[model samples]
Target: MDNISARENRQARLKRMLAPTSAVFIGGASMIPAVDNCRARGFQGPIYVVNPRRSELAGIPCVPNIASLPEVPEVAFIAVPRENVVGVVGELSAIGVAGAICNSAGFSEMRGGEQAQRDLVAAAGEMPVIGPNCPGVANFADRSVFMMDFFGEHDQNGSVALISNGGSYLSDLGSSDRSLPVAYSVGLGNQAMITAADVLDVVLDDERIRAVNIYFESIRNSAALSAAALKAARKGIPVIAIKGGRTTAGQRATQSHTASLAGDDTVASALFKRLGFVQVSTHTEALETLKMLVHAPKVKGRRTAYATSSGTYAVLGSDIAEANGLDLQPPSAEAAAEIEKHLPPFVHAANPLDIVSSADDGKKTLDIYRAFLSGNLDVAVNVMCYPPEGGWDPTTWDTNTTMFAQAARERGLPAAFVNTMPEMISRSVRERMIAEGLVPLQGLEDGLRAVSNAIRSSELAEIVARKSDEEILLPLYSANVTNPIALDEASAKAELANVGISVPRSVVVKPDQATSFEDLTFPVVVKALSADLSHKSELGAVALSLGTSDEAWRAVCSMAENLKKTAPEIAVSDFLVEEMVKDGVGELLVGIRRVDGIGLALTIGIGGTQAELLRDTATILLPASRDTIAEALRSLKLYQMLDGWRGRRKGDVEAAVDTIQKFSQFAISNGERFVEAEINPVIVRPQGKGVVAVDAVMRLAR
Candidate 1:
């Protein structure tokens, strides 16, 4: 089916799942709290309590079983034992129930339960089954609660929807004091039928939801999830996520909690970045960031202006902004003059104008902010500190910040409030800031980072939107190779030369046939070439700078004898004789690695022996355009050196870019024939000189 049809189907399923007019509670015990939460949250529909032993629950009439229900409920919450869950869910689906939340455990998460989980999913059919071991689902907007507990009586329905794999964390965040406006909260236990991606699509279809926050341990269907997230990102709906497993210990923990395979951390990070989702680490950061995005979110550029009531804060704010990638450039002469009118004589009129404490009543402070904002700054910040001790009157502070926010919103300028001491800012004051559409930031550094991230999210969202419709083709391996086989350097170099990439003048000669090298240039390299050996250098199988035929012959003979002593198990079949490449300004390592879920990632880094130690590399996901190649290269630390550091002559960066592009194409075309490929020390020469692949390696997939 096309995307629109799939989206519509999900939307229809979600409508029944989240805002069901009627529900049935299938199991006894701890499910009472779920039913009570639903009622308390204003679910006035007919609730059928199904229990074989009890005739009633909480003064409500109960049925004996699924077959005894008066009618099929639009939604059902199944808390039966593990063995009975699949049967109950199948019955629900047969009865034409639209959705069900299975809260039972021991499916896929327990040993030997994988098939059980698969059966549970198959039984649900097209109906969305939340989990077989999850906390349940809820929609605060419509007051259809089906979770273990609900404490959102104080919450106002807002834009952000949170979906989590671990039920406990979702409960904690749902009950926090941060006052985050939640539209829907779901605990995706095993994600049997509906995954994080499926839920994301459902929420994105709703105009009421402006953002989504996901806490997932594992991704079952990544392509669907990525497509949904990219779709949301293109529409300016920020999708923020905090993946659980990013380390070995953490991966094990996640696996124990929810039978999830937390793929490579590096690969996951690259995937998040490529899809334009803001990846956060801590819960505090996630809450604050969601709040910020819910408030004044979009900004066009990094240029920012701030007004502080204290001198120390002014200096600190400037440093914080600079560190966060914000430009605190001096305003135009006219704009500077306008700002000076409101500033006290002692305070210099600058990017971060320090309005003295004498103007604490907030009129002059507001005016200073207004002046900078009027000058077309992309973002404006108001720094407020030192709340009155016992005399902490919050009304005046609230009014002042609210007015400032209004002015900024009217002008379409992103605004933020920096509470230097978070403890000093009262909840009322924070609420006022949020209500007025201004980001309430806590600490100077944290606040600046939040603002910077907000701006970056907008930039990345634009990038996602720009490329949303473009299809990314992943590398598929060939089925002919049963086991991986490493290609000798001669064959690898020959393949490289066929793809418009330059390689050294080379020839393959056996030990018995190596008589004359007069046809080749001087200063040659001779090394053993064997498909069985991959790391030839480590085995003393390589010799460089053989300037004559006699030297080349002697080097090959010595290499053969050395290989015999070190590795008697292997045979030195032949030697590759090549002209030694020289005069390169820099060396680079370019390779392709297949990442789980995300596909091929082309890595380019500083080359030679220290390449692994330095790890100074950047990656470009496959199906990369020329622009992405250049951008990834420029992001590397090696790029500075390549671009003529310390007054050195500029290297052929453009030529390097061309080489990378051609190499990527070659990898894509021949990727199916091999499992992995690399070109080490692709010699980069001075300007106008082309690069050469000095050494290369390719291995067919096993």
Candidate 2:
């Protein structure tokens, strides 16, 4: 059957699933809420007790078995012995249960039987399973259906819903109303089957769910989750996810806890940012960020404006904004004129609107605030921190001094209140700030990161989707690919050259005919053209810049001999004697590597060892556009060098980007036939000018 049919069948099965007599079932010996948290918070959903020996629990009748239930259970919590899990699931599936909280242990995570656990989890036929070993699920706004409690007697704030893999950390993350109102809180123990992707689809499409906070551990299904997250992102629903396990030990712990396959944390970080998700590290920070997104409106663009009561807070705010890719627009001439008349001489007009030394000056703050209320700024940050030390504490600042925030809320501009005195702030004051549409963050960095990430989550999705439009029709070279000798660099370049790319002048040299320097030219490059010597440079199969005729002949003979050392028995072929290409404006490194879940990722970086050491690299998805290629280059850490650092001439940035963009098109065009290739030094020239490939390699996919 097709996807729609499969999905329709799953829905039908879900509808027939039984409803639990106890809406919230506790399978473990977890501590229950002593206070009337459920009734106080308007949770009228029935609470069910499923202990076999007990008759009643939490003032409700208890059922001995699944068949003894008053009605079919819509959801059930499983925490029986490991050996009995399969039998319990078998019965639950047979009875047509819709969803479940699998708290039982020993499926795959702690041990090594991944396949067995996967099969068992699939018994319910794609039914959503939270964990085989987990802390269970909670619907906070649906009336305290959780064994654990974050707050007492807290009403539905209608702000953000949170999902985490690690329950220990989230339980400690201050879930007070002082942050944002949390709609739901769920912890997936092992993430047995139904993943973050499926759950996110519900939140993204739900009108009541404003923003989502995902505390991720191991990502088993990245592509599915990414697609689901983008759905939420497109609807302006900010998703802040923290992929735990940055170190070896951390990764191991993560694997044990959630059976997650943790690879490189940097890769995970990069993936989160690229896929329009805000990546965080700690629970304290993720909580604050979620609150900010819930409190702040959707950002229109990157530009930001600042209006603050203190001078030092402005600097801290600007530093944070710039570091996180948020543009703090400089005050316009008109805004500057107004600043000049009322502001302190020391505080010059700039990106940060520092109404200098506002010791007793509320007007300076108000004037700057009102000016920015209609200025070129898309967002604003009004800092309430001490001099030189940025903290988040409302009690430290004058509580009455909230006019800057007032104007921002009135204008519907996304804004954050930056406070440095986190410890000094009272819970009541913090709640007041959140109620007034201001997110209370620990310091400058966290505050700006929260805002920038939320904006990037929405904007990056649109940006990446644009990449799907420009498709390609060419391929790259690789060594592992089949029939390498039949299609060498010269041949591959010749092929790509047909699809709009430039290749340098070259000629193939047979073993019988060796060319002297005087005959071939003063400077020439000798490249072994045999599949037997794939990694040419590694096997001394490549020689560049021959000064004399004798040296050129010797180099070729040596390369021919080394072919045996490179690939023992493979047949050898003629080499290439090409004129050495001259120095150009820039050396662009372009290569192709398959990215898991994202398909092919065309890489463009600074050539030579810096590409590895400095890691001054950027990536573009396959069939990327000229605009995306150019933007990707600009996004690198060492991109300033391409823009002419200090006084040096700017490398041919445009030409280099164009070449890579074309190569990406080529990679996609060739599809399965082409495996991979890399052009280390592509010479680039002036504006909109063409580029030349100095060296290239390709391997046809076997």
Candidate 3:
């Protein structure tokens, strides 16, 4: 089937499973909770149970088997033994059931379970299946709960869809006290038939869903996910994600420095960034960020105003704001004067304005807040820590928060009510703040981080929306390669030069024939050339700065002798004589390689001998625009030197950008033939001198 038809079919099946009008349970007493939970959540649709041995379960009559069902149900929850899962799913599909949640275990997660998982997928052809080893999904919007584990009671008016690969984390999030507004929670275990992308696409169609949160160890379908994420970006919805298993142990062993620098995690981060997904490190940050996006007004930039009653909190807020890249500029002179009228004499008027004296009077507090928020600000934050509910009168806290919320709402700025500690704010206070159109964020650190993420996400969403589909979307490519061949440095440089990249003028001659350097300039670089030698400098196969022909010849003889003593088994038959780049201002590593799950990713960073030691780099998925390449260069730490640090001359940044662009295009054009390509120490000369690729390495599939 074509992509359009396949997507439509998947969507239709997911709609039924998520918002089922009728559901059937197929198992023994173990399926009682699912049936009862569905009924308890006010599922007004018909419910059926299929068990051969039992006559009834949870006060509901049980049918003998699939053949005895009254009619085809919209969805089913199967909890039979692992071996019978395929048979039951096949029976359901034959009768045209929309979808099913395969709750059976021992599929793909155990020894010899791979075949069972494959058979299960084949049997459920065209039917959307949630999992073979997962707890099912919960739709608070429609009150349809088909999960095997106990899910907590949630407010039916949630706007975030929580999808996770770990079933335990999904269950914990569903039952936790974080009070995240959730429209749907899904545990995508194994993803045999339905992938996370499939779920995202289906759920995003629900207009009630404002944002999405995903937690996964690996992406099952990257192209589909990219499409779905792009859809979300176009719709102005944020997709927050946390990628687990961020390790480099699985990186492909290659000859280029790019492989070691751009590991799986780094590539995944770049993919997420290009797709405009807000990536967070922890579950708390994810939850808090979702809350901010869902409840608070949209943050346009980082100009923020922090209000607190405690002077210490005000100071701390300034520190945190600076650390998180928030601009906490002081109010205008007139605004400061207006704020000073309401504050005590000792409480100075600043960005994190202390309004302790005015906290008692609602009108005074509102006056101060209105004046403070009227300045050039994108967001307003108030810090408050409420004492125990019964121990103290709640009148003062209520007045301050209410007036602050009102003032922020009047200015139409995103507002956050942060507590220094996570547990200091009572649930009632949080709900009250929410009712007043304010986000009650827990923990000062996490709250600010959430605000930063929200603002950045909004900015990224705009960028994604403005970009053409071809610029943002990665085309599908096969990452498989067989017996890759490594090209020697000279041949690699020649290949790059064919693609518009500048290379030093050079001639490759046999080591025995290195009798003269008449074709090259005086000061030259000589290197032992062989495809098998990746690190020539380490093997004493490279010589630099030869001022005369005799010097060049002597350097070549010394390299031959040194290599013969160091690496006797390898033969070095040729040497490349090249002119040295003297006016170069900086050196950079430009590399492009195929990331298995993701597409070709271009990594730009500090180059030369310290490339890996410095470890300063930025990666972007392929098909990147020149603007994107320039931005990546600016993000590097060495960009300071390239941009004329101190009194030094500026490097040819435009030429560097062009070189990166050409190399990226070459990689894309030859992606099928090459596995990895790298140009280390691309000597960027002074402005107008252009750039040169001095060293290069390439691995091609045989």
Off by over 4 Å in 3: 110-115, 249-251, 509-516, 568-574
Residues 1-702 of candidate 3 have per-residue lDDT tens digits of 997898798899899899988999999888888888888877879999999998999889999999999999999999999978999999999999999998889998789999999999899988878888878889988899888887667767989899988777777666766557888999888888888888998888999999999997877667888888888888888999899987772355577889789888898899999999999998888888988999987899999999998888888877987898889999999999988888888876788888888899999999999999989899999987777656778788889999999999999888988887777577777888898988988888888899889998888888888888877777877756778898999989989999999999988877577355677876999999988887888998888988988888888878888888999888888888899998999999998888766778899999998899999999998888889999999999879999989989999999999999999989989868867889999999999889999999998787
Query: Which lDDT values do the candidates have, in the order given?
Result: 0.76, 0.62, 0.87
Model 2's TM-score against the true structure: 0.75
Off by over 4 Å in 2: 8-64, 144-154, 172-177, 246-275, 279-285, 301-318, 325-377, 385-399, 407-415, 435-437, 454-524, 527-541, 547-553, 559-585, 633-676, 683-702
Error of 2 at 584 (Å): 4.7
- The true-versus-predicted C-alpha distance at residue 401 of model 1, in Å, is 2.8
Who wins the lDDT comparison? 3
Model 1, 245-302: lDDT tens per residue? 6554223221010112122565566667777888877665677677668877577788
Q: What are the root-mean-square deviations of the candidates from the true structure over C-alphas? A: 4.9, 7.1, 2.4
TM-score of 3: 0.94
lDDT of 2 by residue, 479-544 (tens): 223442235667767766777778766677666785434445568788877543444566677898
Candidate 2 achieves a global lDDT of 0.62
Clashing pairs in 3: none
Q: What is the lDDT of residue 4 in candidate 2?
A: 68
lDDT of 1: 0.76
After aligning candidate 2 to the native by TM-score, how far in Å is the CA of 670 from where it should be?
6.7
